[model samples]
Target chain A: MTNIEINTYLTFGYLLWIIAYLVAFVAFRDRARSGAIFRAALIVLLCIHTGSIVLRWVESYQMGIGHAPLSNLYESLVFFSWSVALALIVVWRRFGTDLVALLGVPIVFLILASTFLIDPNIRPLIPALQSNWLVAHVFTCFLGYAGFAVSFVAALLLLVARSSAKAAELLPGKKLLDEIVYRSILIGFPLLTLGIITGAAWAEHAWGTYWSWDPKETWSLVTWLVYAGFLHARLSRGWSGGRTALLSVVGFCAVMFTYFGVNYLPGLHSYF
Target chain B: MKKSKTMETGSSESVSILFQIKAFFTSVRTTVFLLFTIALGAILGTVVPQGEPLEHIAMSGNTFLYRLALILDINNIFRSWWFTSLLGLLTLNILGCLFQRVPSIWQDLRGRNPKTSFKLHFRSSLTIAQLKDRLVPVGQEIMRAAPVISGTRDTQHYSWVKGRIYLIGFPLIHIGIIVILLGSVIGAFWGYKGHMMIAEGDSSNKFALIPSGEARTLPFTITVDGFKLVKYPTGEPKEFRSNVRLTQDGKDMLTGSILVNHPLTYEGISLFQADYKVLGVKDVKLSFKTKEGEDLVKVADPRHDIDIPGTDVKLKTLSLDPGTIAQGPGIQVSVPGKSDKPQLVSIYQKDKRPLNIDGVEIRFLGFTPLYATGLQIGYDPGVRIVWLGCTMLVLGFILTLFTNLQKLSIELGGSSKGTDVAISGRSRKLRKEFRQKVEGAFAGITELRRET
Candidate 1:
């Protein structure tokens, strides 16, 4: 299929994902399990989403410009949702089949929403991003970001789970939500570490200087520190569950700044 | 002895009260909470403008708020003193928090084991069968030996908890915070950032000095060999690369392409491609009128004073201001010892007419471009320390996320609960997780996690 057609399909999948999740959220009040058709459709949508990413890769290759589809804001959002999908599947394995669907709507809709906000044109990377590390560096960072997005969504649910008595009553306890959140962070933090390192290493290769305190660089480190604090509080201070949710929420806010604030900041990393 | 004791006792009460107050700020929660506030403030600073002059802020639909934001330095938030102080306070709070927690975290890092049964570890009710099954997996994850007893049924569930590396996550993250703070702090005081533009053939040592504009300058010297702006077929700029020879004290430090988004650094001096501009140069022919004959001196220089030989009048090029498509570049020329009015004037371009003078006529010459370059120059002596701390910080996070202290014991012997069931025990920060894993293994098991 053509690139536009593939994107259309992906958009349709996102719509389905939203529907699945909205219904799942409503059903969560009744402690209802997902129907077979709903489960099958959600799985199909997830598969289609994954296929779209791979299709984007193929499209890039077709243009004779072989690069990862993660060089821009649009591509990153698409990849972010992909990461969330993979992570939610992992959460589903642990939490049960239905609870996983609860997170799908936000992840999918957020990705869908980003397509409208970011410029959709596929531009070639400047010589600076022509390095081999561009793909590795950005992928790891966004994957980690995507994982954090999952944790952020889970944290939001935890906030709901904390207040919505029936939701918590039927679902796994605050402890399980905490576990899922921690696991997401646990998975995401290291990837973020790798992302930052890879980005720095790429910077060293491209720009001779490893760290420039470029706004994006600074904010990424700041976000990492915030999440680092979260992991620290949860682990060392013997805090878990509720507190972990709050930390992830804060960290994701930092991630938002890292994504959007750099352009507005006066510092060096404003190049978007 | 009684008088001396009374004299000493008089100040003890005040000393104890002072110590109590001093201890409050030094408390772990207080220090951490304070650091949290600083972090929050730093986030706010990024949102708010930091270092900007009042009159300079562009009035984008609102003249009042933009003017106020400029006064607050909200645009340059990172460099502002208030923001810097917030960073400094954050650094101190993190250090204080780390100092308070490091000893215990260090002990945990040294691989201490918890010598306790799962029942005791729970601090809640636990069955003997539940304790044994948790031992094997938890032992493998933490790489610590399971605390299962070798005794038949007479074991007393002895346990001594140890998990200091688990504590290192906090200190490691604290060190990361300190590194980031150090980078920003040192960068705040020592870092110098500004931009200078160099045309196709430009070289200057004083590029370090901020040019006569409302912009900052660099410290080291930079010579631009040639600026190459590679563009796509559609004319969109693909990349702007500059081959620059960076020097400090006449010694060539480094030379490479400083492209867009790629900064070249040498001896801690970073040259970034902030932007580029074109400077247009024009040529004009000068004629000095004499009684015997005319002396025609061709000049391209825009200097205000050019010596007119054999004549008292000095031919000067006052200014070259490009007017319009029909007019092109204008050159106003005047001779010293002459009137304030231009003795000779020329609007130079092949497309436009030239200016005539008294007893001589000046012809308009062609034009050439001089490109202006902008570079952000920053030199932080503490970047290495900050970078080292950043590396360790990333490493510590990786360890914490991937590794943990886990303890599980599976007793294969006769039941300790007076039943003939195999007893299993488990312990982990992921209480629910360990419960689920253990529960899945045991038939009809209803496991629950109780945090201590």
Candidate 2:
């Protein structure tokens, strides 16, 4: 299929995810058969989403530009939504439940919607971006972002489930929710560290400086410090429950700012 | 006796002072506070335009805010005294925290038993005779299941600990951070960065500093032999390379080429191809045709005069424009004998542009573009140390995040019916998961007991 057709398929996949999540939420509330149907549909949509991304990459090759579909804002957002979907599937399969998917679905939808708002046209790579490091850097960074997104959703659920009995009944136990948040951070932190290191290596090659204290770099460091604080407090201070949840939420906010807000500030990384 | 008493008091007073100082820096609360403050400063640095001149910031129309920024050194916050002091304080705090915790962590690792408050009671039974044979096999199984540090056997008990060695990764990570900070300090004091632009076939031994623009001469001279710019079919730049030769004491030292993302290093100095610029025409070949059906060709140098073969009209080359929208070169020429004003004449390599100057027709033939390569030169003695620290930091993170300290204790008591086995364990991280594994091991041991 053409790239445009692939994009259409992706849009359809996101819609299907939302619908399936709604079904799963209902199933969670009422203990109905819809949960099984939702699970089947989710698997189907994930396959289609993965195919769409692969097709986009193929289309780039056919056009002879021949880069991964991850060099621009539009492609990164689409990749991000796909990552969130993959994380949701993994969390669901590992936990044997779709409770967290109720929170995950909306985030993927929002990001996919934002993707549509930006340009999706495939462009040739600039000389600065024409390196193998681009693939490693962007892929690892987005995966880290996806992990934090999942953790944010889990943290939000933890806060809500702890306060309201109705929410608690519909969700997993508070302990499990906390565990999910911590697990997600455990997955993201190392990936983020790798991403930063790869970016530094790339910078050394492209700009002759390993670290320039650019706005994007500084902001990434800030995000790292915030999460480091969270992990430190949890591991050493024995912090858990609401305080850890709050830290996760705050950490994700910092992540969002580093990803989106830094674009407006003038820096060397403005090529987003 | 009086003097000894005085000395004791003095020593005690000094000891208390040291205790208070260590207590202040070793507090976890101080660490969290320092992290918060550093993060805040970094945010401010990113939000405000940094490294700009004071006058330029003042011209942005917020006089009071600019003054306040100047007072707070926000214009260069990353290198400002306060920010640097905060970093220094953080390094000290980490060192202090490591000092205080090392003793305790060492003590915990050395202690034989788990630090749990739970107590175990042992009793003998009929299967006490089989316990001796089962003890070795059970201990082996536990060691195989996890990373066991040590195993001990008693008459009725078998115990082993796994991953206790990984506890050192925590302190190693803190030490790595300090190493990184030290590297930064060394870089700040000793490193230098400068920029130099060398035209093709030119040489220079001096460059201007990046911040202050002060020219500094190096002990060696660098010569640019050639500069090449390659473009894609789309007319976008693909690569820029500069061939350079270094000379020390008027003798050839090294010859190499620097490209984008590739650099040349010699004698602890590195040169990077940061940018390039095209100069005016080097030489131009022009053909002039007279109305008498005769051809006159002359090669003209830019900024030089050329005489027409059959007329008093003199063609003087003024300047050349590397065509922006049109891909060919355009030459500006002046007819000194005919018109005093210089006229811009377009030239194309494929399609010739004929200009009639005072009734003498001149066709532009060919042109060459000269370029200069801009190089960013840096000398940093601390870069290797920084890279080493980075490597250590990643390794420490991997060890600390992925591994945990675990200890498992099994107490087997022989009862009148059979042997009753109780298994309990503790983990530094992921305790719940460790407990489940211990329970699984316990079930396996029970199955073995029945089989035997």
Candidate 3:
């Protein structure tokens, strides 16, 4: 499909998801009365998301040398949010919605916005990226990033829950938000780790040395450290809720730098 | 024997000292601080040109600032001691954090319920009194409840439920963190990196090693057999590539065309196609002298005076540098012992003019263009550790998110009218969701009881 066609589908999916989210938020007023409507809207948005992804996949195939729609910045953001959507649905199903979705939706929107900064022309990857590890690395990393985004938002909500007694009435209290945030980071961290590992392996294959301290690589390390701190903070008794959430926010900013700022940075990583 | 014993004792003392040092490094705060500093250094490195000589920045701007930047090695941050130490500190911090935290987490995971507060609470979960209501006698029942729904207090009608696969998730988290640290550390310690500029038709693997103190060397020879720049109609490069080979024992080990990003690798070493430069056809040249009978010598270069072993005839170029005068592309030629105003012999792109040096003669050789291909060379031993660290970190994170110790306990006392249900829950990390799950579980129970 052409860029216009793909974007049209994407825009439609984006609208559908937003509508579903709003429906769910409004439906929460009387949950019993709104279950059917919420489920229906959610199903529509999810189905639309799946369809859009499939179409994108098909579009790549039509270009002859098929790609995973993740070779560039815009594609990465879109894919990231898509993974978040799918994973969030699974989380909602297995764990039941306890206002975690509230934390998840904004992340989806942010990822969508990231697409604007990224070039959406669907260009081929450089010769350096023509390795088996590229798929494994990007897939796992973006998925991990999406998971972290969810956790970050959840962590924010957790602080909100803790700060105000009024927040306790809204599905998740501070404790629940903390757990969800921790859980999100837990899932995201491993994926990030996998992503980094795969990237290193690929780097070794392509650049001879695995760690080059490239801006992208360094920022990735920075991202890892913040999450590591978050995990370690648990042992010290007081790095949870707001502080942990704040750290997570900082990590995502690092993530953005690694992904986008590297190109602008005066380093070998600028090529990527 | 006494000397041996003393040696052992001294060794043990040193070992103890080492252990103390290791212990100090393993602290959480140290790791955090290390990460912070490394992050700061990395930010600096990104903002500045890593490993670039000050000449580069000076080539671009102000003398004072350039000199200062040069002094600070801002252009060469990654390889500098201060920056490297920050990285080392970051690695140490990770090790330290693991050293201090893993054991405790493991103990928490391994610590069995030895009639402790946890066991007491576990027993107080909602299965005991409810069992009496069911047909299964409180003492002996035929069926057991689901895992998520089984617990009892220390009353006479209670039974301890062993639902702890979920409780055993902390190790996975710890293991993941450790693995990630291992990967990064391995990468840091075990890798080597360098760069080379291989010209077309060049065979020597004399890679121009980057100045990295002690850790540098080429394990094998990489030859640039040839390079071609295929251009578009617009004169832009459509594709540029170099024929490359890794050779050993006079045998080619690997051969391929390396283009942008498509590097060639031998064993574990890879040569990246980093960059290329245009040459001004002066790198190699051919020279000839019309001898007594034949075009005796098609000398590759005139710098090396070729002696026919037994003949007194020898030819040498007086000048070998980029010599192209306004009128003629000529080199000042000379003969041994009898140098009379060294012959100014002109050479052309294609040999056209012959040198008439009174009685001597010279011919223009073909031009050799200076072709330089930039190759990035690297070897890293710490990469595997880095990869391992990444794995651990990833697994730890996933476990933290996907799994949790979900526990709910309630003690019900018969009050002749109805039973009182006290509900409470505890989770290791994410308390918020744990509370909600417990509350939801209670609500579900209330709904079930009401329906019944």
Candidate 4:
């Protein structure tokens, strides 16, 4: 299959996610069986999404440029959305809560929609990217980003659940939500640290310097520091409730900027 | 009496001042503040173009901002005094915090219960306890259900703790950061980076350093045997490789290839394939016809003067342009006696052009191209230490985050109501989950009692 065909499948999955989200929201409001149906549909869409990614990988091989679909902007974003979906599925299975999907699905859909604006052609890898480290580095980084996305949704849920009694009844307790946010961050922080370390090793191999103060590297450091601050504040200062939730939101915004905003700036990592 | 009171007050004031300094360095607030400030500084460094010379910035019509950047050293913020000072302060703060907390963390690791005072208050269902036949069996049951670190039994008290080992991770992580800072300082003081460009079939032992713009000679020479550039069907670059041989004292030490994401290292220095370029024409073959109608052939270097066959008006080649889409190789030639100014003549690979120079017909034949490879060389002694620090940092984070430091105490004592059993615990992380586990263990004991 060609990349265009794989993109079509991804578009279908995106649409399915939107529908599942709406159904899940309605179920959350009315306390009906639609939540289960929404979950089943999400599982099915995730399968299709995985298939499309595999197909893209195969297409790259057929074209004589065999590499994983984690190279450039379009591919990374697609994989990012897939990672988010996978994290959401894991959270749902562990907690048996579909409230997270209400916020997660739309974010995934928006990311997939943004892919249409970017170039999705399967281009040949440049010499700088021809390494085994690229796959490990980008995959771990996006997974970390996915974990932060889930935490962001959990934090947003805490805020919403606190404002309305009706919403609070449908959602998990405030303390539970706070713990979820903390756990998601706990999962992400190490992964991000690993990603940065691997990126530095890769840079050393390519550029003869580990850290050049490049825009992308500096911004990733900023994101790490923000989350580091969040963890320190919560652990030592006993920050919780609204303060922790607000920090989570801010940290995710930094993640978004690290992923997207740095592309507009002039840097050595522009190829991503 | 008045003199004694004044001296006492003076000593008290000094003591309080010393205490305030210690507090400033040890507080978590200082850590938070330092992190945010460094992050902000980093963001500003990325937003502004770094490492640009002040003159360049001034020439860009931002003289005022250029002067400000010069004063603040914002042009190279990472190496600026303020940024370095911030890092130094952060390192000091981490040290102070570790000094203040390590003793307590060490005590916790030694299995000393810091919170010896216990209140007989039970509220959550998870903390509620049921009377058991003995305390040891209850502690054993809990240990069998989950991993337990330590168990203590007294006349009427028993307690079990788990995950106390993770308390050491906090101090280990701080020490790892300190190691990393030391590594960076060593690199800043002793390490050096330089760039070198060598043509095909050439050798070089010297390169220009980046910060000082001074040339440094190495102990070994690197020879570029060949350089290859592979392009895709779309004319985009796919790969670049430089086949090189390193020689020292006229003996070949190492021979290998270097490409992007791959570097060749000899001793402590490394050479990376960074860039390439085509320099100029190597040699050009020309065919000429004399005034007697006899054809003659000759070779000429683009940079040097060449005597055209059977010509007194000495001909010289000034330059050659390797062709592009807009034009072909246009050779510039000058005849000292025929004309004072040089003339341009176009040459192509497939077609031959005859030109009249000093009344002699000259035909351009063919030429060869010369290329060069750019390599970045570096020598660093602290990279290994930095890598070690990174590994410890990751390990420390995993230990501190995944392992939840928890303490559980099962105190059995008699009360006014009955033989009161109180089960209470504390956790640094996953408190709710730990509470549920405690509740599950209690439920198991309650079920056994009913069976009896």
Candidate 5:
């Protein structure tokens, strides 16, 4: 089967994992055993996802136009979902919470499922995208986006736990959720900085201008500024719980807008 | 009474106002507010097309928005006065906050006896001196630093402080941002960016500046040797390279090729391959078939007329067409006819049948496209400064996120029991892991009672 078919199957695999995690959390009552089984399944799926990405890379080489599979929208979406899954697993390992996996896997599934709507054929890179910085810039930026995605899920849980006591039982404690949000941002903020830096470096090399105030570049700056505000609000103002969680939600909205909305505007970043 | 009288004076009133100004600048709330405000302004800048002329914005059809955009300078929010003021204010606030926190941060960096977060009390059977010796190695192993040994012999204190560089994290990141802004300011004041298009075998040393159509002269002259365009088998462009020779006063300076990502720099001015354009057809190839079915092929320049090799006929190319309804990449040629009238015939590159003229069949072949490479010339004195600031920013982030200062203090004193020992420690991160390490290290001393 082709890599696109594998991606479709992996999307369903994530949906199955979500269903299995929820079922095991509710029906079995023995959370650890079921969590381990499903976690192993998730890892197996991630390995397949990784293999598919590598296979796509090799396919591009077989086409005689060798390049990383990070040159277009479909590959970005694929890498995005994979990064989100990796981020969720890392979060679960660090905090020992399966609730995040339940809450975050659906986002991964949605992002992967959305890739079916766009073209998935591997094409040659344009002259402007033929640079080593292309891989570095996209890799760092998507990982940062994944971190923000997980933080966004944690923020939603924190907001829900405030209103519903039943969710408070199923979810992790408020403090742990808040810490997760903060820690995820801490990981994302630096990676985002690196992404912007690499992007500027690439632009300087390709376009002769490090920054031209393009719409896409400006939107990335806006996202960065919003997250900077989030950090300052939490670290300096001593804000937490609902207020910080709301800030995280707003920050993720900016991230999404930076990713998708700027395509509607006229800028140089037309290739996703 | 004297202080009250002074408080009623004008100088005292001015002092209080200054104090309030300082308070506003030193507050984190102001920092957050300014960050969001600039972000909102940048969003507006993107939504509205920036760097456009005022006339274009005026013709945007909304009278009220045009007037507002004109008044607010929203057409160029990044360079507008209000946005610059916001950035300046943010820089001032960061400096103010940094100045306000430096003394405390410095004290913490140098402070010997910091307030502990976790404390453990244990009764040991060893004397105070022996306990100190035993605990020094434990502190070193746990905290990865030697103790300061800063108490009397009766109640000696062995404190280990590691990763003091973490204290500089906030300063480094904030100052790095300031330096970046400073570098940008320097670039804006001194940098020059412009574009020049040079066709193959042509060269110029002047370029038109961006946004404004003003022309600028370069120090050295650039001669275009050739322009190469490589395409994939799928007909997509793979690379564009311009071979150029830089000369000054008839002396050759540098000769190289400039690709899209591989720029050519000389004397602090760099030339980047920005774009390309097809000026006109350079040469065309044509195939002629004699009446005897013999084929003859020759390359001819489109700008000149051609004579038929075996006939008393002259052909002049009137125009070139990329393609027509029944032709692919054909050319219209004017031929001198026997009836004192010029005849027009079109020949295609991939025509199934050749055109019969004067008992000779002629067919058009493919032509070479002439391309002019667009080069962007840039000169910025502050690019190195900007790169330096970026390095500092990355280092600052690594220090802030990856390192932590952990302090372990062991206080030993004599008591009715063999000896009383109190262990206190604090870490900026991983509190549980630090506590576990301390507990594992001292498991044999006593059943350590943890106190908040």
Candidate 6:
């Protein structure tokens, strides 16, 4: 089957996974059992998702225009969904809770479903994207973005817990949610740094200017700075529970701007 | 005595102000505040166009906003005085924090008696010697290091500490960021960026600096031998390459090709394939058939007139079209008659019917587009320093994220029940897992293990 068709099917699988998680949440008293059910189904679905991405790569080579499936908007959205789901599973395993995934999986489903709106044909790579560094830069940035996406979900839940006692009871404790926000940033910040570094190296080779202060480059820096402030506030100032959660939300807004909003501006960093 | 007391009070007041200044720079609040302010400035820079001239803003017809932009230097926010000062303040804050944390980092690295996070007590049937043999390996395996045996035979003690390298994580990461910034500053001062456009089969040693059209001469000459644009079957550009020859004093030093993402460097100045422009038609191929049924073909320069051999007819190309009219690629050629006016004829490439001029048929063939390759010249000596700092930053993250420093202090003593075992430990990560492993190692001691 085609990759887009497989992605469409996987979107439904994620929806089913979310439904099963909700059912287990209300029905089963044992949290671990519910987490196990959600985790097992998501893993099988991700395996198929991974296979489809590989198949897309093979299909491109067969078409005599071989390139990694990360050169345009449609492919980036697909990969981004995969990364979000993978990152959510990692967080669930590390923290031993599926509450964050309850919110994160829907984001994955939305991103996957949105791929149908754009063209998904495997086109040849443009001249500017003909470097191996393009692969490295995109891979690191999206993984870091996935980490931030999970952090945003946890932070949003923390904020919601503050206002509603019902959410407070249904969600994990305030401390665990706070820890999730911090720990996800801890994983994301370094990867984002590496992404920017690789992009600079690629720019120096292709454009002869490493830091051009382009709109996209400036936005990425803005995102980095916001997260840097979040880290300092949480680690050094000992700020948490509410204030740090707010900062995580702001930082993810910057991430979204850097990903989607920068395309509206004129800059060297276009495409996806 | 009263005058002397007033003088002493004044001196103490001055000392207090200086102490407050030190406290301000070293505070984490200052770091967070500065980070947010810089981010705000960058956001403004992106929203408003950056690197544009003040005159351009002045022409925007909003006098109040233009004046505000002028006062704040928002036309180029990144390089404005305020933004650079913010960066400088952040660097100082990092240095202050680094200096304040060094003593503690050194203390941890020295393997001093660290604070224990938890303690466990157990009563065992074995002697102190038997306890040491079994528990020593567990400590060794967990910490990945041998213990320092310290107590007497009655009360045996084993203390294990590992991951001393983790102590440098904080310093390395912060210092690496400072280094990257410093490298960029050095590049801003010492390096140059510019572009050079050279047509195919042309040589140039001069380039224009970016954003300022000032000329600068290179030490060596660059001759573009050829430029090619390869397109995919769908008409999208696939690759651009420029074959160049580097010459010094008329002697060829090197000959190579530069493609996108692949630059050519000579004498520390690298040239990247930035862009390309089609200047004009290079040459056109044309085929002519005389009325005597003899076929003749000649490659003619579009800029010059072509004279028919053994005839007084001359053909001059007015324009060349690349299949604009569905009749395929055609060229407008003017054939001058014996009168004062010239007759224009349209000839299409690969057409079965050719244009006739004075009993001779002329068919237009394809023409090559002359391209000028734009090469970006860069000379940055600080790029290596920036790369070094990036490596250190990545290494620091690896050490901080993957490694966990753990310390174990175990003391075993003889008791009335059998033996009294006291185990206390501390870990930076996975405290519960570490506790479980320590307890599982001593579970053989039987039903008396408890947290203290």
- Cα lDDT of model 1 by residue, B1-452, tens digit: 99999879878978988877556534545544654665665666555554445455673556775864656456655565566666666566566656666665565555343332333222213555554554445434443444534545634332223343555565676687678667656754675545566766667654443322454444456788766667765555777777888777788878787875677767667677767776654345554444456656556565446555454456677666676667666566665334566555545564333343444444555444455666555465766776777777777776565555555444333334342333334444665565566545443334433223
Better of 1 and 5 by DockQ: 5
Return the clash pairs for model 4, or none.
none
Can you tell me which runs of candidate 6 are displaced by over 4 Å? A19-35, A266-268, B59-61, B121-127, B152-155, B288-297, B303-314, B322-329, B336-341, B350-352, B358-361, B412-421, B447-451
* lDDT score of residue A126 within candidate 5: 78
Clashing pairs in 2: B125-B414
In candidate 1, residue B1 scores what lDDT?
97
lDDT tens per residue, model 3, B154-205: 4332332333444434555555555655555555566556777777767765
Please give the range of 10 consecutive residues that has the lowest summed lDDT in model 5 chain B. Answer: B443-452
Ranking by TM-score: 5, 6, 2, 4, 1, 3
Return the TM-score for each candidate structure.
0.67, 0.86, 0.63, 0.84, 0.94, 0.93
For each candidate, report its DockQ versus the true two-chain complex.
0.23, 0.58, 0.27, 0.69, 0.85, 0.81
* Docking verdict class for candidate 5: high
- C-alpha lDDT of residue B149 in model 1: 49
Q: Per-residue lDDT of B313-404 in model 2, one digit per residue for the tens? A: 77777777556555565676766532565555555544444777656778777776678889998887877777777787778778777777
lDDT of 6 by residue, A28-90 (tens): 898786678778888898899898899899999999999998878888888998999899989
Report, for candidate 1, the interface RMSD.
4.2
Alpha carbon lDDT of each predicted model = 0.63, 0.77, 0.61, 0.80, 0.87, 0.87
lDDT of 4 at B63: 76
Off by more than 4 A, model 3: A1-6, A16-29, A94-110, A113-119, A159-171, A260-264, A268-272, B1-41, B48-117, B121-191, B197-202, B211-220, B223-245, B252-268, B276-374, B388-452
- Off-target runs (Cα >4 Å) in candidate 1 are A17-44, A64-66, A113-118, A127-137, A161-172, A189-272, B1-28, B54-82, B106-170, B209-223, B246-255, B261-263, B280-376, B407-452
In the range A1-272, model 3's lDDT, one tens digit per residue, is 56535555555565566666577667566764464455455556667656666666677677644666656566666677778776676566655663565457556666676566555664544556567787788899988887777776676666676677787566565665676677777677777877887887777666665667777887898788777677667555457778777777787778767877777765665434
Report how far residue B422 has shifted in candidate 4, in Å.
4.5
Which sections of candidate 4 miss by over 4 Å? Answer: A27-32, A162-172, B55-67, B114-142, B145-161, B281-369, B406-426, B447-452
* Residue-pair clashes per candidate: 40, 1, 52, 0, 0, 0
Per-candidate TM-score, first chain only?
0.88, 0.93, 0.84, 0.93, 0.97, 0.95
Can you write out model 4's per-residue Cα lDDT over A181-254, one digit (the tens) per residue? 88889889889988988888888898888888888999999999998888888888899888889989999998
Model 3 chain B lowest lDDT segment of ten: B135-144
True contacts kept of each: 0.20, 0.44, 0.39, 0.83, 0.82, 0.86
C-alpha DockQ for predicted model 3: 0.27
